[model samples]
Target: MTQYEVTETSDVKGENCPMPVVKTKQTIDQLAEDDVLEVLATDSGSVSDIAGWADTTEGVELVDQEGDGDVYKHYVRKTE
Candidate 1:
């Protein structure tokens, strides 16, 4: 995966499933095309939720994803 510079970051740690995806969507919206948004979440469900959201969303791309300790790091890129 290409390493992307995070133009925006949203930390939804301790939040539930929907909050991670919801906050990611909001943060992604604040980014411009091709900009990367890094989301930090502790909810295990967020791994799938954010990935699914990026899959279903038209302009968001799930560029990278990994787990660090209890934190799930999701890298989403805003695309045209």
Candidate 2:
């Protein structure tokens, strides 16, 4: 996985479903434009959830996603 210059990191390690995506959105909203957010999550569902959310949402981009067993890492960027 390529390293990203993340402006913030949101750890939702044990959280599941909406919590991961919800927290990601909230955190991303607080970031400056072009800032990158690194989201660490343990729930496997977050892989697809975050991607889907980013895909449909405006001003947010899903830069990258990586998974290692139960741990998942998502890099999201604030485009606006």
Candidate 3:
């Protein structure tokens, strides 16, 4: 199992694009190695963006994802 912290959340209920991805990255960076981060976003694009970022990045792991309606949650584990 992975431990996660809700580092940041965006109420971008009506926002779109880059903002969601940008904010998610910002929060992911704040966590320590092996620590997981949970990001709350409202942008649909974040699903691909966040997953892509973790898959392509060398030191990040996209652990899981879940969403309810407009709110999307992403879990990322940092790797050193």
Candidate 4:
């Protein structure tokens, strides 16, 4: 498995729909380039929403993702 030294974390566990993605974009914007942001979310749809959002967003990279039970954790590296 890949290990990341997360510099920041956003716990949007209970948020649904655009909340997770919104928080992720907001959080990632605050991070410096190359810094890792870890996101904890309970909404399963975030798995795809975040990924897709990151895919189209600039200055953000989806480094890793994991799903455990009802929780989804994602790692994003700021590129800009």
Candidate 5:
């Protein structure tokens, strides 16, 4: 696993599907350039959803992702 110094954390643990991606995008919007946001989600589909969102979204990077059974952690960085 890669190490990340998260600037903020967004908890959407109980959310599913588009909620995770939606919340992540919302949180990322609030972050400054180069800031990292750690998104905590319980939805298994978030792995792909978050990745795809980051890929298509400009100025945002999917830094890393970690999964431990029920919890999914996504690190997103804002780059201007």
Candidate 6:
């Protein structure tokens, strides 16, 4: 069986674009393979930024996503 763990979570509500992305990257770097990270951000751009980052970057997998009101939640898994 495969085990997934929540390694980190960031609530970047009211924050800007790069901040959320930057923080997400920092958290992802600390995670081991298959570890999950849930990031909450209010920036609308975060959806694309984080998704794009995961798709473009190596060793990162975007697992899930949810958005409501001004908050966007992104679940990412580290693969490398």
| Ranked candidates, highest lDDT first | 2, 5, 4, 1, 6, 3
For residues 14-40, could you state the per-residue lDDT of candidate 2 as single tens digits? 898999999999999999999999999
Q: On residues 1-80, what C-alpha lDDT tens digit does candidate 1 reach at each position?
A: 59789898898999996889988888788789999998999999998998899999999899999999999999999997
lDDT of 3 by residue, 1-80 (tens): 55566544445455578776666677767767877777777788888988888888888888888898979888777787
Q: Judging by TM-score against the true structure, name the best candidate.
A: 1
* Pairs in clash, predicted candidate 6: none
List the candidate numbers ranked by TM-score, top first.
Answer: 1, 4, 5, 2, 6, 3
Per-residue lDDT over 1-80 for candidate 4, one digit per residue giving the tens place of the 0 to 100 score: 65669999999988999999999888888889989999999999999999999899989889999998999999999988
What residue pairs are clashing in model 5? none
lDDT of 5 by residue, 1-68 (tens): 65568999999999988999999988898889999999999999999999999999999999999897
lDDT of each: 0.90, 0.94, 0.75, 0.92, 0.92, 0.87
Model 6 misplacement above 4 A: 1-5
Where model 4 places Cα greater than 4 Å from the true spot, the runs are 1-3
In candidate 3, position 18 carries an lDDT of 78
Clashing pairs in 1: none
- Candidate 4 matches the true fold with a TM-score of 0.94
**Candidate 1 error regions (>4 Å):** none
Best by lDDT: 2
- Deviation in angstroms for 4 in model 4? 2.6
- Which runs in model 2 stand beyond 4 Å of their true positions? 1-3
Give RMSD (Å) of candidate 4 vs. truth: 1.1
Alpha-carbon lDDT of model 3: 0.75
lDDT of 5 at 62: 94
Worst 10 residues of 6 by lDDT: 1-10
